[model samples]
Target: MTSGMAEDHRKPPMRDLLADAAFELFEEKGFEQTTVDDIVARAGVGRRSFFRYFPSKEDVVFPDHERCLDDMVAFLKTAADGTDLVEHACEATLLVARMYAERPERSLMRYRHIRDVPALRDHEHIVIRRYEHALAAFLREGFAFRPDGPLHAEIIAAAASAAHNHAVRTWLRNGATTDAVAAARTALASVRAAWGAPPTPAEPDDYVVVITRSRAPLQDVLHHVEHALARIAPADDAE
Candidate 1:
């Protein structure tokens, strides 16, 4: 094999190495007792290497969030928009649920650490807000035709984030044996029921047409068509 291929084959990424080392130290020493120095030592890397991957020890505790947030944004951007705006927002939040579900043991450990550490818990709120903002931004664009578009976007975004968090946290507390992704989907469905626009009342002279993928979810079709009909209202009626 070439030198670069051999290097890739022999070692995990430095980011993963640093995260694994930090999690190990956090488990043994506890979040408060574990230091950046200890984590770098365990990883066989220098302090600089740790800093390269994480801004601080707290950042290491929640390593996957940045990538998860990016995934959420991309998903929202390309997701079949034929669904209810609230449902779309809920669907976007599932990316985070999947991330936690992918590593249940690690998620459980991180949950414990967050519960025990005030600073880590506070940091986690900040991380969660980023995800909420991404969802809201996507929804805002979808609702742009309505005068209350921004308000609608923000409310649904918060609802989606709350539902996703509720499911994941409940699963973590229960030892994560259940399906986290399925739980999130169920919770989000409630958001769709609560805030999802109703189907446009069919009018003899008014028909709304929406273009979407053949494989798009049924909810998407209902949402898009409803919103399309809603925009056809008179200017004063829209207000």
Candidate 2:
């Protein structure tokens, strides 16, 4: 049997090898000029291996998004009770930022290629929308109590997505020199601040204390007080 260390000495995984080969070809020739055959030939793998990992050439440009989207969904699922849902959504976007930051050079190359290619640019938008939809689905459930829950969920999700893209694009444009994760945190923090749940007051300063005669039954008095508070709530909300 081959030892684990010995296995490590072999070529990179088929998926990665295909991606590396495809990117190299994309850089050497234009994205439109690079063929799957060229990529497989460069990687020394079969054409079947390319199809196994990526559906098409466009998919190769975004090899990591599917995994990142799954991770974003899972991360949102782990939110604790009372966690701010908008903030949670914002945090999920950082997962993508970190994915790109993990391999700055490769990310920068992908960014340039996408910018120059109209087809890839359109495909990238679809990929981005998938991430937004995942966030929106999670937020929609959390915000169900609100009357405008669906609308609020979509707006917050879009805001988070836009903030994340801005931070990442800025980082890539500036040569990826700055802290991408930190930039994402800062951008997403702004979204959280704008849309996160408002703090509930510990105690209302304005309250009417009702004193009932001792002769009255306790349960009846409690019910009356609750009814009075319900009546007052609408007026308080208006103010």
Best by lDDT: 2
Model 1: residues with Cα > 4 Å off, grouped in runs:
1-10, 80-83, 199-239
lDDT by residue for model 2 (1-239), tens: 32324434477766677888889999999899999999999999778878877999999988888889999999999999999898888989999999999889989999999999999999999999999999999999999999999999999999999999999999999999889999999988778778887655576545666889989999999999988887757667688
- TM-score, each model? 0.78, 0.79
Per-residue C-alpha lDDT of model 1 across residues 107-209, encoded as one tens digit per residue: 9999999999999999999999999999889889998999999998899899888999999999999999999999999988878888887656676336546
Model 2 lDDT-worst window of ten: 1-10
Please list the Cα RMSD from the true structure of every candidate, rounded to 1 decimal place.
11.6, 9.5
Q: Show pairs that collide, candidate 1.
A: 82-220, 83-220
lDDT against true structure, model 2: 0.89
Q: Model 2, which residues run further than 4 Å from truth?
A: 1-10, 199-239
